[model samples]
Target: MTDDLPVLRGLLASGAPLTWVFTGDSITHGLIHTRGARNYVDHLHELIRGDAGRVQDTVVNTAITGWRADLILGDFARRVTHWRPDVVTLMIGTNDCTTQWLDPVIEVTAFAASITEVVRRARDDGGIPVLQTPPTVDLHHAPDRARIGEFAQAVREVAAREGVILVDQHAAFTAFSEGTGPGNDDMAWGLLDDAFHPNAAGHALLALGWADALGFDAVSSPVRTDLAARVAVARHPQWPPA
Candidate 1:
């Protein structure tokens, strides 16, 4: 509704085949937290190819475990540009908040600079850049990284200043936490596998946000609700079978 992804919509609406490259840290990598389940990009891949009838659309995931924006820049061309993607999705800043032995300001400043550089390089290399803010974490368990909110703020600023397509995953997760976050123990609000990494359900939320932003009719997809539906079985006995 806000016209956030006009360029991407144009590409999709044009009905021409296009490639999308996803790069970021473990969150985007669909690490152990996903427990062998598909990540958000996988869901998007299905939407673009199967649902949207764009069978030729390509989705590549070059995300790495424990990597940050600075680390991605170290080998940008290989991980991103080499694919000659039409759209490049960046969902970083989580690990940037936890980098060891660096001042908070320094880490965020470097993170912002690295993000900016990635956007510039993506645009220069003929790719539309899409920025996704890192999702929320359980501060009670990750007390050391309590200031992660600052990093989210930084991503918002970067998105606004860069004038690129913005997907506010952090805001979405934050709203979820505010509404249904457990009173205690389940600090992650049942969305994360641990204190940080998102689990399958969390990944579904991420997918839903991206899908909605990319103008997909996501409400009917398993990616839009409890992803466990795709598991072919209900997560709890109290719930009906998927």
Candidate 2:
């Protein structure tokens, strides 16, 4: 870890103003809650602004609920390329592991290829790519532990081969799920609601993992936002409504 600090520092100091594009399923989309600040992306935005001391950093959340890797890749060719973010983080595979698409090996391989392609395109267009393994879900409720593990492994392999950074969120979440440390609680496994989608606590855990992967000091402080305010601004009559 000591030896890696210099490299991390260098990456941080790079002249480019950091622009992160987060892509994935409902987690990335910030679902299971009302529109506005309740989602992870909003939490992430506040965290970055407070910790990094710069609100100029760009972040785009292109996540759609119930999306798979293939669907995400389809949009990558258009939306992602246009954004050209400095770093792209992906948190997918949950939807792919559903019973509707249970071919773990094939799905993992395809997902990995999609990620590789996105990275390659980013490089060609001048950008850095970072991949994140999906967080650990409630296996008791989801009943797809083996497939999830396989998907995580595939993400790691793809990241290595592509020379991109990989955040092993699955492993970290598992450590917490198994009662390893501070995050050792049922909420850490996103089981509070008996669903795979994480609650506020779960998203907070993810933000910490992201901070570590990005070589920033881990801070557990929560940055609360006014959901009504954000929604009001987003839905202003001057702008188009979703």
TM-score of each: 0.86, 0.76
Candidate with the greatest TM-score versus the true structure: 1
Error of 1 at 233 (Å): 13
Candidate 2 residue pairs in clash (backbone atoms < 3 Å): none
lDDT of 2 by residue, 107-180 (tens): 66676787778777766766677778887766665775447778888888888777777778888666654432
Q: Which portions of model 2 show Cα errors greater than 4 Å?
A: 1-11, 14-16, 33-37, 101-106, 144-146, 180-192, 218-242
Writing each residue's lDDT as its tens digit, candidate 1 over 179-207 gives 34235332435567778888777787788
The alpha-carbon deviation from the true structure for residue 110 of candidate 2, after best TM-score superposition, in angstroms, is 2.2
Worst lDDT run of 10 residues, candidate 2, spans 232-241
